[model samples]
Target: MESSKIVKALSTVMDPNTGQDLITANMVLHLKVDAPNVSFTLQLPKLDADYKQQLNFACQEAILEVYPEANVHVHMQNPAATAAAGQGSGGPKTNNPLPHVRNIIAVASGKGGVGKSTVAVNLALALQELGGTVGLLDADVYGPSAPTMLGLQGQKPKVERVYGKPKIKPLFAYGMPVMSTGFVVEPEQAVVLRGPRLAGIIRQFFEETIWPPLDYLVVDLPPGTGDVQLTLVQTVPVTGAVLVTTPQEVALADAVKAMNMFFLDSVNVPVLGVVENMSYFTPAELPDNKYYLFGKGGGKTLAKKSQSMLLGEIPLVQSIREGGDEGKPAFVNKEDQVTREAWMKVAKNVARQVAIRNELLPETRRVEMK
Candidate 1:
């Protein structure tokens, strides 16, 4: 029943990367005990798909051996894996000195085409409307959709000098500053870059882009827990992460994996909560009728099981998808409709959760990079 005993048992689990026990690798964080239940998060070095799967199975086995009755939760963190996190100073550099940007949150999904980018775009606009300066970073190097979603397609970022260093100024859209790889490269060209080169490009996007002072910088991450995700976590001092998923078995399953990635020992990024998108489909004609296009409550169930908040559930609206395809998100429209209302609710929930998180953890002063 003692958590210390559980910790000691975990010490036997070795990290293949370091060839040392997880305890010796400093992979365990936030270990807690409550009677018969034991909970802790495991952090791991940036791991490839094969190693990640192997580690996950090994952790489960270790937990069962320690406490067969205890509920075990394993979270994986990939340190210095993505381009954004990898490009930062190798050592413990102080946080970036950007007072205008209060917090940077990444919107991530384990699978693509789940409307993650759409949610991110609307959420950023919604945050701005809630009386905060916002910046949107399209870190989806493979398919940077912010440009199209925000109706800024084919627009190039203006160049400016910041402290004698050249920087690319973000394009403005509805009072929000937006930057994306889409603006820098041809759509067809980006799809061809290899993994390492893609990481370099993402790093360059952060370094070369000129992001002004803002209240929130929401990054739309590339789908999956791969090199790109790892790179961003390492380079940027992300305040937290938001997992987006549809209320379907497949999406929810992958979403849990994405959440586990953040809980990993090396990743250690706080998860704000899970946002359920396309929870139900409602035809415009039948505003009152809600159709369960996908399985119901998958997201809410996942949130409950993980003990994380259910930020909000957005219905499947044709207008929402049409708006994104047309390069104008529904949230930006002033008309009061069901779709707009849904987005507004999601936005408010995100802001409220972020405010609470900020208050609880008090923003870490920007670390200085020497």
Candidate 2:
């Protein structure tokens, strides 16, 4: 009978593709209760032009089970319009509006399951540890895993008025603010987004989310150099990118594609460097022994071939994965030398590259057009 309990329960209902629940997906909006007379609105993103009726029926069925006698309503809207409406006034109405964020660094991978999101989460946390205001944007629309990785699966962004306009207040973890598309949809709903729709969602992540003054905003892009990646590169003035790869030939090939995507004429974001994740596995008993589980130096070789720096090599450790799953990033584990040192190396190298890029690059206003 407790409204909070019901809300909490509903938040656990995750969308299958994104691994994020409906409440965090922003699907369940405007919940109200007058004693037992409860009321709420469910906003479902229109995934297909022909599935309006199907979506409506699905929403109705989903709501009735939880709120038996409660009044419920479902609405369908274009994803672009929905995203635009979320961004408040005084914010940039243009395609790219996050002007305050000094550096936009995309943490990308050529393929999935190479610990891309893990690299992104730790890198952002490591940057925050270095005393800068950091924000993490989970732009992996297909599989928005930041919510679970950051331990914010059940949290909802609070709404606030900025200049009389509604703004989405990003959720925080260990002082870093974060926003994810996973924060907006149900698990069962398909994320069947086309190129234009994907672009609109990324645009909304910048415009709608109320990101405070930040020195760096690390974007955790979806794996692959696909439509979503292309859209973000074209739309956001990405200052640089950090390519992540496992020590494997297949992963290295894909990582190369990811790097080349940035070099494309349409998407000219600078390639900051490369990070080699799970570079080696070290057992606690024999700390000195290095086991190349995925093959050694693939990332280093790739970086050398591309004429980019090999930022750092992170060892495979159980705690790194555990920490990510538990919402406490391994970078914060100062007591654990392996985890701490590994992340610190990666963080320092990334920071140094960012500094060098800022100093050597032309002023934002004076940079020559392609």
Candidate 3:
């Protein structure tokens, strides 16, 4: 019933990494209590798959002894990566550039051809459908597909003067705002700039644009762990990330790498969960049939192995593919109940995971790396 009793229980569980009780090291954060229910976030300074699982069990056991009827929710968070020498001056300070935005989620895949962009686009639409104000940022600068995916091909965001300075207005589609490199260059143009130049472009998106306040901003990142991904993570205060992958060994390998990046000491971005896109196939005619075309359970395995949540498993649907090519994401089509429901499931899971993270952890922002 009292928060202190829960804190006292948590203090009994030793963190394997530090060999100290979580309370002693300031690992417990955002603690709250109600009769027969307790919730708090545990910010582990370091984490691995095995140790994290052990810590969760130990903490739960410790708490249940104090309140046998407790409904315990322990949200795990990784600490902010230490700033490198000459990267920024002083200790880590919150560098939240877009205070108006409630949450910024990066959707990434281990590699290309895994439907990461498709997932990103539909997920944004579905989030909007759930009565939340959402925005989409096509951070894949080299191949900005959000413009086409959102039915905004050949469109450009308008620039307007605001307070004696020029500001770009994000284009709206389905009442949700969007911005992307596709709006600036021709459809076939290649973004051949180096890291520094890419970082500059991303910086402008955060500091210069006049984006409306939003509950969630879904950023579709380019596949693979590259400079663009690093630029966005280092330059922006990403709330969290959702990983996309197929249910195959090869794709799972890369998804592991992508997931690992978020856990890196230099990155330290909390991964909301893993979404297993193209998990399987089911024929349109035979509604009751199922097929393991890409093998099965890769997403669940990855999530379990990484100690992250397996948000949802999306089956391979033809209309889902057709919708993207036709400049209409499947989630927006109300007539296609099957496709819409599949994506809506993922969207709901994503929203739930993000909500837990936001409630438990401090807002993440770009800190100067001195």
lDDT of 2 by residue, 308-336 (tens): 79988988988888888887778877878
**What local lDDT does model 2 show for residue 51?**
41
Candidates arranged by TM-score, highest first: 3, 2, 1
lDDT (10s digit) by residue, model 3, range 1-370? 8888888888887654323567876778998887777888887644466656888888889989999999888888654433422356654554445655788899998889898999899899999999999999898887888888888999888886532356778899989888898898899876799989888888777666766668998999998888778888776788899999999999999999999988887788889888998887878887667898999999999888777798888889788888888898888888878778888888898889888888888767663443
TM-score of 3: 0.74
Q: Which ten residues in a row have the lowest lDDT in candidate 2?
A: 361-370
Estimate the lDDT of model 1.
0.75
Per-candidate TM-scores read 0.71, 0.71, 0.74
Candidate with the larger TM-score of 1 and 3: 3
How many steric clashes does model 2 contain? 9
Off by over 4 Å in 1: 1-99, 362-370
In angstroms, give how far residue 23 of model 1 lies from its true place. Answer: 47
